[model samples]
Target: SQQGEEDPQALSIQEGENATMNCSYKTSINNLQWYRQNSGRGLVHLILIRSNEREKHSGRLRVTLDTSKKSSSLLITASRAADTASYFCATYNTDKLIFGTGTRLQVFP
Candidate 1:
């Protein structure tokens, strides 16, 4: 199974600001997804964008996929204190889910 790697291992911002995370993969994938994890807790799926899709959004989350570049990006709009978490990007390779290293986002109020 291949793995996606997120850039800038960590991020910090204040409440009301936005956070952006980028991911790069080594191979083609079926779908790309984003997840958020708080500290040591489990991850919560944020959004999923298929390879054929250019962009998708849910609430404050905006995801964009670029097949040519084998990359994707996640953006959180108007972030809040509760948005603080570790963000990850994942892709489906064959029968497995390959996850990125993750970006730790700290939202300070």
Candidate 2:
């Protein structure tokens, strides 16, 4: 299975603080991508880090991949209320993607 599991089903943080989430997958993947969803809307791609990459950064977001452990983590620095959303980690195969349940992040002002 290409399923990825994310910890802390939910998280609550104050504005300007940082939030971190972790994910673990079962099978091998070509790449892993992070996505964000506001409310019940569609997911928006955040970042894509290949299997060979150890770490990647996009603006305030930083991602680390550990192929040995088959896991990854995402960190959002200096977050804001606008960052309140559901974050998901998706494992990509040749044909499709398998998404984690997601971590619902609530940023309070």
Candidate 3:
């Protein structure tokens, strides 16, 4: 499948702590994107890293891509309770976006 799968289907962290999640896919992709979805809300784009790039960072989030392994990882630093949400990794195909089942993160104060 072109879609990816993330580990730790769920994670819980205390406020001010860091959280990391890993994703693995089966096929190559032009680009990979990470998104956040608040409970019952639409997804909000967090960051996107191109296949040619090895790593990228945005605000408190860090993303790494390994094309050879068709895998990626996301790290959220100093997480806040407000950051509690479901995170998904999506790969860009020709005309559609393929997303993983998603990792549910809960940040507790």
Separate clash counts for every candidate: 0, 0, 0
Name the regions of candidate 1 deviating beyond 4 angstroms.
Answer: none
Stretches > 4 Å off in candidate 2: none
**lDDT digits (tens) for residues 9-48 of candidate 1:** 9999999998999999988888999988999899998899
lDDT of 3: 0.92
For all predicted structures, in order, the TM-scores are 0.96, 0.95, 0.95
- Worst lDDT run of 10 residues, candidate 3, spans 1-10
lDDT string, candidate 3, 8-68, tens digits: 8999999999999998887778999998999989999999999999999999999999999
Per-residue C-alpha lDDT of model 2 across residues 9-108, encoded as one tens digit per residue:
9999999999999999988888999999999799999999999899999999999999999999999999999999999999976678989988999999
Query: Which 10 consecutive positions of candidate 1 have the poorest summed lDDT?
Result: 1-10
* TM-score computed on alpha carbons, candidate 1: 0.96
Error of 2 at 75 (Å): 0.2
- How does each model score on lDDT? 0.90, 0.94, 0.92
Arranged by lDDT with the best first, the candidates are 2, 3, 1
Model 1 lDDT vs. the true structure? 0.90
